[model samples]
Target: MIRVLVVEFTRPDAAAVALGRFLRDEGVEVVHAGPVDTAEQILRTAEQEDPDAVVVLGAEPPSLPGFRVFTTAAEAAEWASGGRSHTADAPSDRAR
Candidate 1:
């Protein structure tokens, strides 16, 4: 199972919570860290959790090497659910 850490950097973290729930339903291990104040804190938490991916909501993701940063929860959920190839959802230009 894929492991992910959901971090909320802004107020009203409902989106982050929803993301965690969705990930859980998809059979992915979801770790939530909240009330995050700084980028350094995010990094520290990530190191401790050691998740495969980190989802940042309501803020820009910190530059963390070797870790995938997702700006939106939906994107993270899709990836966790094995839909990493976004192109699959894109409309085909050719009409068959």
Candidate 2:
């Protein structure tokens, strides 16, 4: 099962919520966070979730651990399009 974290603004909620539900139904652990107002908050949340992938459904980009961040749904789609490649990093504000 893939664990996913989401950092979303208003621009990305619809898709984020929908995907979170869909993934959860599929037996994937989806950690959907936000109405995230800041990158720091996202990093903090991701640390706790420790997800395999961090999905940023927002107008801008988010930063995660060993994970990739996306600005829009289409970008996320592309990042996720490659299947295994989607399982990249998690969110983290820490440098170490």
Candidate 3:
């Protein structure tokens, strides 16, 4: 099963909760990393969890390699499920 790590900078809002449920419904293992303050903190969580992908919400998009930033929970869910086509703005190995 696909595993995804969801990271946020602040308390999870309705959208974040909804995304967790959506990912669960799609058969993806959702792991919540809770609130983190910096990009390094997020990277640490990712390393610990080692999820297939990382979904960042609210926080500024970090420079971590292979991380995806989404403005909305729906968009993140779609990307996680392979429903969204890759684009220049999509997740890449390049760091920002």
Candidate 4:
């Protein structure tokens, strides 16, 4: 299952909330409502949840130590899913 860390500014937009719900409903292990304000928490949550990647919505980009930014949640989620798409892909470990 692809775990996701969804960050939002003033709560999530409709699509963002729906995205989290859909991911969980689809049996994806999502870190639901993982909204955070600080860049540090975002990084820490990523470390703790060890999500495949993050899906940000309605929030400014944060300067994290080592992370990529995507325009949309779908795009990010797709990028995160790429690792699971191929049989030859290596498993990823959550880093702290």
Q: Which residue pairs show collisions in model 3?
A: none
Clashing pairs in 2: 64-91, 65-90, 65-91, 66-89, 67-89
**For candidate 2, what is the TM-score?**
0.66
Per-residue C-alpha lDDT of model 3 across residues 20-56, encoded as one tens digit per residue: 8899988877888777788888888887876667777
Order candidates by TM-score, high to low: 1, 3, 4, 2
Per-residue lDDT for 4-93 in model 2, tens only?
676785454778777766666656667778687777788888778766667777566654556556655555444444444433363233
lDDT at residue 12 of model 3 (Cα atoms): 56
Q: Write model 1 residue lDDT over 5-56, tens digit each, in one string.
A: 8898754478988888888998877889975878888889988887778898
Deviation from native of the Cα of residue 50 in model 1, angstroms: 0.7
Against the hidden reference, what TM-scores do the models get? 0.80, 0.66, 0.73, 0.66
Which candidate ranks first by TM-score, i.e. highest? 1
Per-candidate RMSD vs. true structure?
9.2, 5.4, 5.9, 3.9
Error of 3 at 93 (Å): 18
Top lDDT prediction, candidate number: 1
lDDT score for residue 35 of model 4: 55
Better of 3 and 4 by lDDT: 3
CA deviation > 4 Å runs, candidate 1 = 83-96
Worst 10 residues of 2 by lDDT: 87-96
